[model samples]
Target: MASPQYRLVYWPGIPGRGEHIRLVFEETSTPYTDTATTSDGLDRVLAYVQGNVPDDNINPPPLAPPILQHLADPNNDTNVTTISQTSNILLYLATHLPPGSIAPDPKTDPNALFYLNSLALTALDGLSNEPHDCHHPIASGLYYEDQKPESLRKADNYVRVRLPKFLGYFERVLGSGASGGGKWLYGGKFSFADLVLFQCLDGVKFMFPKAVSKYEREGTYAKVFALYQAVSERPKITEYLKSSRRQKYSDGIYRYYEELDIEP
Candidate 1:
């Protein structure tokens, strides 16, 4: 089969949901273009969210950014196929890459890519719960100050209960040697799942250092952390992370709100 042409559209600021897709593309050394490059890039992104997104599909995507345009389609000009849910995007990229890549063969392998992705998705869901508990006041759309009391209450709960639960899961997964009996998230291979976990870990650590510290006391998942470092340094990934398209943590979903910090 011919190499698949690629173009990735995502939000302009912050790594957010798009970073996972970016990491997957980078890891495979697949050439792709970043569609959102400026504040205007976000404008283009918003339009897709509100207008261009297909509503009639059996599996309509849940949110925006990280939409992959499959440029290799022959039946149409730049035929677009979008999959949201960060984990789903990761799974898609993992299985669809050119043969003999990082992804294990689903038909013959003892551990399937989809199964590992499912586990990683569960971890991500837990991480999101931790963040929401840190700042969920009246609604997700409001500013932290707008929900200070609720945010404080929620953050308190995160430090006490939720943080350990999520971190513990990762620690166990690593210790289990699930990644092909090697280090990392699953099949011991670098998959999109690892990128998602890394982003979640980075965001939580950035948001709640004290809580993260407390969780770290249970012992850091050094294997996954090391894998993260390795993936970050990959040629294409390193370039994208340093490029203008790479958003600072300040903007978008995973804000480093000072108040979100709690005493360990």
Candidate 2:
């Protein structure tokens, strides 16, 4: 029997962190099932993270959404290999799929995978996580209105300090020899890392337009914005963006509160 297709399990309706994984599939034109869009999707996602499934040795239960499950072991029909975490999923796709589909094989270039992952992790932390914190500085369980005042302070500092730090770092990376003339994050090739950065930066731009535009106008981080544009224009990505599968940034990780758009 053939192996089951790659199944991406994540919350529906918003891009959220799952988008980073989605881009990889789209970029490589790999066939996969996005469970979130199917009928009764959330119920399937809930099963893994909510402990609705029986636990065993093939794959441990996951803690949250953005799960990847593949039934690659044909010999054992019952055990599915489950994996979680944004970077972990990306790494698995990069390495497990044909090498260079998402990134160069580590055997050929020892530093490529690690370098890409490190950059992706940094973008996730400073751009994605930090922006989410701006709206929920007090607690994730609380509503944004419940923590508006503290959120204002956090958003202010993020726009002025954290935002610039991340943008500047990516800008420098674009200029570094590793970027190969302002195209990718490493070694002049489009890796899963580029896809990860593209999603994170897209979220950053959506959340802090004024500040992102300010840095763009300065031309200091020109390459950072350029890389974003390049990724946005990729044939597959462009199509995905126009498709309904590309969820809009709403209450998810990247939210645009007018007050939080303060220019740095």
For TM-score, the strongest prediction is 2
- Model 1 residue runs over 4 Å out of place are 1-4, 38-40, 52-63, 74-78, 99-102, 180-182, 217-227, 233-243
TM-score of each: 0.82, 0.94
Q: Write the per-residue lDDT of candidate 1 for residues 156-222, one digit (tens) a residue.
A: 7776777776766676776775656536667666656666777777777777777676655555656
Report lDDT (CA) for all predictions.
0.68, 0.87
What TM-score would candidate 1 get against the native?
Answer: 0.82
Best by lDDT: 2
lDDT (Cα, tens digit) per residue for candidate 2, span 1-264:
554468889988889999998898888888778876889788997787778877786677788889988767645646677899999888888888889888998899988888888999999999899999999999999999999999999999998999889989998998898888778888888888888888988888899999888988999887888888999999999999999989898888999899888988
Q: How accurate is candidate 2 locally (lDDT)?
A: 0.87
- Judge candidate 1 at residue 226 and give its lDDT: 64
Name the TM-score of candidate 2.
0.94
